[model samples]
Target chain A: MLDQQKVFYGILGLAVLATLGWGMSTAGPAGLAFAGAASFTIGGALMCLWERSIVRSAFSLMATFCGVGVLFILLGADFVGMAQILIYVGGILALLLFGVMLSPPDMTERKLVRVGGGLLTMGLGVAWVAGKVAATVKWAALPIDQLPEPKSHAEEIGVAFIHPEQYVVPFELAAVLLTVALVAAVYIARRKMSDFVPEVASQQENA
Target chain B: MLSNITTTAATTAAAAAPSENVVFHLLAEYVPEGVPGWILPIVTASISVGIVIALISVMAMGFTWLERKVSGHIQCRYGPMYAGGWHGWAQPIADGVKLLMKEDLIPIGADKALFMMAPAIVLGAIFGAFVAMPLAPDFYFADVNLGIFFILGMSSLTTIGVVMAGWSSNSKWSLYGAMREAAQVVAYEIPLGISLLVPLIVAGTFNLREASELQGDFYGMGWFVFKNPFMLPASILFFIAALAETKRAPFDLPEAESELVAGFLTEYSGIRWSFFFMEEYAAMYLMCLVASVFFFGGFESPFTYMAREQFGPNAFITNVVAASTLIVKSIAGIVLMMWVRWTLPRVRIDQVMTIGYKYLTPLALICVLGAACWEAIF
Candidate 1:
């Protein structure tokens, strides 16, 4: 009389427990940290898939982003971690939630094709990132074995961004582009109210 | 030579070095070596959590008491004089007990999980932000190099909780409240962070301790506002944005009583209802504390300088004085917020957006530009 869902969860829990024990025996703290981050990411994705409500699913997506932020911190990129949370969770997700108007549309139909397509895309992405990047990329930032005795990652990043021979031009260009994009967004979003409420096309478009 | 973004190369170089926080050091120094090494961090973290929770609870209680008293005095009456002697000093405690004893309710139509989780998220986000707040130079939960930015991000995360609380409530008023909270926070966040940059440019480092220590010159008269001309205006802008950020008067549209019927808390009750209030008071204190550290000399006062001079620099007496000075400055800020809250009427949501986007954002940017120029030339 066991529910299928309960049985699945129980098995999954047992597998996780066994793996954690084995991993701890072999890899110590690194294994534990990896396991924790993986749990957060995978759990978020699972919840995102299992949830019926769109708003809840979006929150689960946020959880996934948060996990990624934690991973960035684990990799010694504190500035990037904070920035990711600030930009993604704080800025982007807030706007998305606002746009949704805190309302979830009732979702009754589940398309098999969409699910299958999404799974395939995700699997392919994981393979491409975890496989090629690990094997090919030369990490000049810091080698794992000779970790620099803790330095201000923020300072390092700030220097890299503004370094004359490095990223200064690209940084400034990105800033200018973002500013232009912001202005354009505002301009387009404005209702076509003209001077003295005269006409619809008498504003930016008319000009 | 490197561009002088932050001054004092020795200090800046040392900032790059990692050091265990005070609590960790204390536990390591005192605790027996027989305990497993891995459990030490867990113990340190739990202790920090315990301290922060206690501090927050006490501050929240005191704020509730002060709010009532301030409101009553503003209206020419005594508030809660009967609950405890001396103007109902125990009123907050009484309220706490009542809230704790009350039955929890969830609307039948409410998303049960979200309904339960919303308050936790709201409270949890604030707690995470508190990690970066340094109580004294030597005493803090964490010595995060990106302290202020980390706090700002965590506060932003609280918006999700507010929205969830509203949406999960299954009430129209809660929905309205949530939407308002998101919009206000989004609009004001730009000005809030930008205005803070006016002082950050002068201080160079985002470490709250470093910022405070730098201002210990001229008998602690060396506040950032004194060093930079644009800082005063920027501080004013920051204060305005902070008011909106914390949803205090003239900006408390999310939970405006006259219009939204308690806003996001329409369906919440008991302890769950109190968590939102706790977050509000804590956030207000945090914003004020940031202001004190950034613009007003955080932990730097004539009193603290004297204490440091009297006792050794790292003496407990100096720390005590410094802690009190910070608490007092933050209290002054809270009182100012309360005064404004009682004095000014709440603005329309449209007006809030207009003010945040149109006025504050531009002014903040101008201040930043002026500060930058002043820094480069001076």
Candidate 2:
């Protein structure tokens, strides 16, 4: 006895897989394009159905995100793939975990459910955008025979920042902005600690 | 203009052939003249995968043994003399068997599913890095064009698994350990990224092969460690940041054994605890690898290239020997980490932040600016 939602998803799964198999057979390695797109769709679908547990859903989402990273790697955007993994998995997800830890424990389940509908709507919108991008974006000029090898992406991005034609001004501005942010964070955090400082007797007498 | 042309010419052959494609080509090359085309790639993939798996497993075991010997010597005793003949070389293997035969325990309060998944994730992330490491010239699993970035990205993923391990254990110590570990990793990553960028700026490309190839011809003391004066300080910063990144030494506030009883790994036992150790050591090795590549010449002997200009495939052996130099250098760095672990007192948590934010960040920035200026002037 399966629920109607599960039945719908199951049917969708068969359709997506059928399309993927066809694409794989026809496109050879090139057909990974469709296969990668399908992974995200199916992964998102799984996340939606996983309403019972947040932990399971989060892990599933991580796997799906990783699959998307693979898709970027396949598309010859090595830097993009690395960035996806580093920022999404490492930074944002870490922040999300922090949020989980900082949140009131009792409200965990309730807050998750309450936010589910909103998250789903946003997820669907993003999925729709992705689908549109997949269908419309062309890569006819890109190489089909050989795959690009891995390189140092941080270096590439860093060097690109130095290149005047590509990103020099933006890079310079970013450094200034980072410095400002650092100063602001340090100042704000330090201001509250002023009260903790002890006044020495000599300094107090001089004052 | 001539130098640029020569340099570009020098990079072409090495940069053009990526590891994944090279593996495929090598497989294709070995096949009989009439063999099916598809079989070559498939065979190459399987072989490459097998090689990578074997290497990771062997290295992991060897590292465990090395740690014992190093730690033992530090403590004024020989370790594992009885395991299997000379110097307990086979001790790790015996330990592995013992661990396998041991009972697997689950804490009553622990989240069963997450507790199991945590170690798997950690091991997976750490092992995934082998796919990018270039063993010798044209020897690697898959050289995704962003190899170094992929390594960094994958390395960072271990924190999630670590945090999961800490949180799922459902103990006060575990939770505190996870939080501390999380904070430490996050704090150090900034300087780590910045310091790594220093070398990248000099090389003018992100490709490791390109960077390495560029260093192949050295007229003077040719390592990037001395490429420019600023590189030395940057390298130092990179090493310190790496120590912090791997939770080693005074930076090892997470696994402060005296304070947290093995930190987030407090509840883990048997081989599960060993998995954490493997992950930690692998990270240490990877950090050393990055340091070697960024500072020291990777797979480039000090004078070998100058002596033989027409080096071909056999040059791979030479490259391997050169790479060993890097391994030795990295091991030296690891030894320094171990030394710090044994000698220095751990700083307080607030002090750790003060050092990271107040000192390391500003110093790294200054080094970056100084390096940039040095490059422009010289």
* Candidate models: Cα lDDT each: 0.81, 0.68
What are the RMSDs of all candidates, in order? 6.5, 7.7
Most DockQ-accurate candidate: 1
Q: Mind giving the per-residue lDDT tens digits that candidate 1 earns over B1-378?
A: 111101111111122224366778888888776876656665666577678778997999999999999999998989889887889999999999999999999999998878988888888778777777887788777677878987897888788889989999999999999999989999999999999999889998988888888999999778999998999999999999999999999899999999999999999999999999999999999999999999999999999999988997898889899999999999999999999999999999999999999999999999999999999999
* Inter-residue clash pairs, candidate 1: none
Against the true structure, what is each candidate's TM-score? 0.89, 0.80
User: Which candidate leads in TM-score?
Assistant: 1
Backbone clashes, candidate 2? 10
Which sections of candidate 2 miss by over 4 Å? A1-26, A32-61, A102-207, B1-17, B20-23, B30-43, B219-221, B303-316
Could you give candidate 1's per-residue lDDT for residues A74-162 as a string of tens digits? Answer: 56676786788788888898898888764566567656688789779989999999998888878665343322344458887889899
Query: What's the true lDDT of residue A104 in model 2?
Result: 30
Candidate 1: how many backbone clashes? 0
lDDT of 2: 0.68
Report the lDDT of model 1 for residue B197. 90
* Model 1, residue B245: C-alpha shift (Å): 0.4
